[model samples]
Target chain A: MDFERLYRDHADTVFGYLAFKLQDRQIAEDLVQETFLAAYHGLEQLEGVQSPKAWLLAIAHNKLVDFLRRSRNQDLPLHPESLEAASSSAPSKLHMQEILEQLAEPERTIVYGLYVEGLTCRELGEILGLPEGTVKSKAHYARRRLYQWLQEGSAV
Target chain B: MSSEEYKELAWGLVYGTLSAEERELALHLVSQDPEFLEALKMELELKQRLAHLKRAMPEEAKERVYAAITGSRSQVLVTAVLKTVLETTLPRMLWPVLQILERSVFAGEQQ
Candidate 1:
């Protein structure tokens, strides 16, 4: 399945998503490996999937959710930097790096893939194994969520 | 266009997360709706800010990962085994021994 090419072409986005979503470098790296491994193995079985990008994303998303549920059940100690970012009055100065640093795990993956990776809705749908419709909807939802969070930054 | 819906579609479109049609529709809606136009500007700004956040994987790690995936460890192992076996083979070694024996017999007879 040329998994290496896939990993080379998409690994950064995948890792970025995982790192942001999982909030742990180690776990994110593990999930990235698992995601590629799943792609390596699952390529043979993915007949009905119309969008491969979305399909992969769906697998990755599920992996993320499973990891989150199994692990990270406890409320984490708040990062002081995020707390400080939240308190700063100059919201416009908020950089993408700061946003990424402050972002909780799931949102990080979705946002990084969409905005930073520059993946389209259809591409996301293919990666996640979702209908293009569903991918678009989720992306829309993700955007709104980001907007809400950005608004909350000033309040912090 | 509802402000909420505009907020959603606007960000999605600028982020490159929306389909081509949705982006067109969002733009159309923004043009027609006064409030949505304002929200669209904010969405655009947010997108610009987030655009700067894009990052690349570390170069060395990227190469290492590629090797891990595509490296032909088995091929190398098999080739090494074949070379070793050829060096140790019966007929291949016997050829050198026969050459040595031929030289001794011919050495004394050579005028």
Candidate 2:
């Protein structure tokens, strides 16, 4: 599937997503391997899928969640410290990061793509492999959840 | 319809995801409810803020992935381990069974 080129093109975006979500460079790198390995393995199945980037992001999301779960061994709250780097000196941005942590992974990715990648929801939908309508719904859920987190003091 | 009930689909609406019928309702709600409109605005803003956090992978990362991809070391390591396991463990596992069967056959012959 021209994997080297595909990896070259989207590795930054995938790494970006993992870095923010994981807040760990080492873990992010390891997971990137797993992500590519997974993508490499599943490339055949995903050939007809709408968005390989989004599909890879989904794998990354799962890997992140699994990593978090392993670390916490519970449905713990966001690693509060992870937000420190992103949020320091910018309270609103931190709030946004906190709010982001409250979102489900799909919602988070759609939000991340929308906010970070500057992709429209339709574009995000293409990447996420969801219908645009579904992608929008997730994006909205993410937004509302973030707002709720802020209003409720980043309640987990 | 109240914004609360509509939130299940709010992502779509915020992202202009409404179906023909739903769009009418969502637009009407947007006009009627300032709070709901504000929420949508915030969502968009939050998306922008989150976007600003993008990070580039450092150079070393590229090298690591490249090495892992091209070096063939891991493949070699895995194949070696598999061969060792098959050659050593497979015989060990079969030895007891083979011994028992040999004893049975030879003992019957002696009888």
Per-candidate iRMSD: 4.4, 3.7
- Name the runs in model 1 displaced over 4 angstroms: A65-156, B15-24, B29-31, B71-111
How does candidate 1 fare on TM-score?
0.56
**Candidate 2, B35-62: lDDT as tens digits:** 7676566556554556557987777887
Q: For residues A1-156, what per-residue lDDT tens digits would candidate 1 score against the true structure?
A: 355556667777666666545445556666766776677667675566565555666677778877767666775442324223223345554554565556554345556666666666566655555677876666566666667766676413
The TM-score values for the models, in the order shown, are 0.56, 0.54
Per-residue lDDT of A17 in model 1: 61
RMSD (Å) of each candidate, 1 decimal: 12.7, 10.5
Candidate 2 lDDT over A86-151, as tens digits, reads 435567665666666666777877767876765666766655567988887776666566667646
Segments of candidate 2 deviating more than 4 angstroms: A65-88, A101-110, A117-141, A145-156, B1-44, B73-111
User: What is candidate 1's CA lDDT for residue A152?
Assistant: 72
Candidate 1: what lDDT?
0.62
lDDT (0 to 1) per candidate: 0.62, 0.69
